[model samples]
Target: MTVEIRVSRSPGERRVALLRDGVLAGYRVERPARPDGVGDTLRGRVVSRLPALAGGFVALPGGESGFLPESECEGRRLPPEGTILTLRVTRAAQSGKGLRISARVKQRPSGPLALLERGPDQALRWAAAHPAAPLVVDDPAELARLRAALGPRATGGAAFDDALESEADSLALPETPLPGGGRLIISPLPALTAVDVDSGGADPREANRQALPELTRQIVLRDLAGPILLDLAGLSLKARGALEPAIRSALVGDGLVQALGFGPLGLFEMKRARIHPPLHEVLADRPLARGLALLRLAAREAAAAPHRVLALSAPAPVLDAIRALPGALEEFAARAGRPLVLRDASLEEVSDA
Candidate 1:
């Protein structure tokens, strides 16, 4: 019904268009010229922090990383050497580097976080708009010091009445599996997106052909990504007729939807009209890795048998999940009946698992 478009004037800022139901609904653009990077948080482990560039790998965090410029690296605690943390995507991922940033949240009285760590134009606008109240400060430590400053406005809650009304709505939303067995994780963005189908999870439906089209619809509506690329395997010749219209209907609030049938490699392509980074990209700080991982490595030192030892290499929080993997791995390793030893990756970090 109502469509809005936002564009920035300077370079470095992204140009975004948000669409719903095959129609234009929103637009946003980035202008490097803008100064506004306050509260953008992304969780990732520092893969390789290169002092030369001042940044490293975050598991291709957001498909890339950039220089964590000395200016942004404000504190010793801020994504210190090799810390698995929530950094901001301040710039395009480096040529061999990736988007780099120190995350902090920037907010105004209004909802919908406008800028995270650095976006000058947006910050000024937010400040001007909320003159009556104190504009949110950007200092990560200082900001964290003020917990209830915003009170009920914290992003997670809604009015009790509206919440009750939403229960049914929330329940109605489907929980479908992804191409792999893992759950389909959707945070919805306002920008275009590129997803990598690295591994699978638990659900069997993830293997279904129908899941492809459905994923497209849910993704657009949730992340608001326009010009999407679905790169999962299989589905080279499945019928689009089974799902297009539903996807079209979902875009009712956005704008035009155009998609080419699945390509030779099974990558389905589609685009929506939008102007913001799809929610997922902004939020996808960390990859979906089970804290406790199975280390079925082939080796000269195959302890007690065939495969290898199962290293419980996660921190305390994920120990439970790691502990649960042994049974599954044991079943898989049973044919050879090899002894699976649980080793820790970090010789120094001793955790519960």
Candidate 2:
């Protein structure tokens, strides 16, 4: 029942992984973007309205567009295309998805709109809100940031080492080992995620009984949302009937809000509202986002690097993202009191920085 939060510097972003009893149950990648738009009020122009979708797209001042549901605009007049109005971001931008925006009315809002934190900050907030757990980070600077985010309750140090890094790498794999030699395979598609549970020849009921709690843990850990279909390996009608109650109890026990039931074809169906993008999506689809993340990591490493110059090697896309944020990158270098050398990809094989 022990929970551990490991914060590490990953290419172009800060990666936070949650381990329950040493098993990677959940993870998040935090990267800065053009104001993730969540919980922030901004002026935007109506780009287009889609009656079929029950919403329209609004182009924010920052040039990115978000979706405005008709429900949110019920009391307000529907502004025409190019009409400017202030709105708040209900959901952040993600892969092939725009922000979920809601209408706002503040005739001369006093100050800048506040933004909701995501990734590392969100993870810290979650850790602080939950049962006390050891928070581990690889960098002293990051540790300080965690302290600032969590206040006095935060207590941890630079505990991430080579061995833990390897453990993290293994834990990140799609296929994860379950207790009792069973395995869980998670496959994500563009529309939804599918989790296949293999009981490994054990009693289907018993194995599933043991696996449901861990499954819920994974769901929370991965920040998985929307539709999820769990394909448990074996189950008879009676077993399924028994499994349903167990699954419900597990989800409730974990304090997770997911509608659970069996589907038409005997597959276990689950649906949870999307609050944030999963770890893979943030790291894979958002290159520029990751680039900003890398810059942030560089700023942190700059302080500890033995030399004044910090060497960084990452994919071309990530480097491009860094270049896109020249001002931020320069500021990061200034704060670290070091110059950064972006390693050429040809000279060194590259992955995420």
- Maximum-TM-score candidate: 2
lDDT of each residue in 1-353, candidate 2, tens digit only: 88887786533356677776877666666653333445566767788988888878887654577888888774644666766666777777664677888876463432333332233355564596565876776655566877777765445565456665565554446887788888888887778889888888877667777788778877776667778888877887556766787777777844446756887777788876666776556546466765665676676566667466777777787777777753556656555665578875755753443
Which runs in model 1 stand beyond 4 Å of their true positions? 1-238, 254-268, 272-353
Clashes of each: 78, 4
Model 1 TM-score relative to the real fold: 0.28
Question: Could you give candidate 1's per-residue lDDT for residues 230-280 as a string of tens digits?
Answer: 554332345433444543444354344565545565555677543334333
RMSD of each: 18.4, 5.4
Looking at model 2, the pairs that clash are 11-353, 12-293, 12-294, 26-221
Which predicted model would earn the best lDDT? 2
Assess the local accuracy of residue 297 in candidate 2 as a C-alpha lDDT between 0 and 100: 61
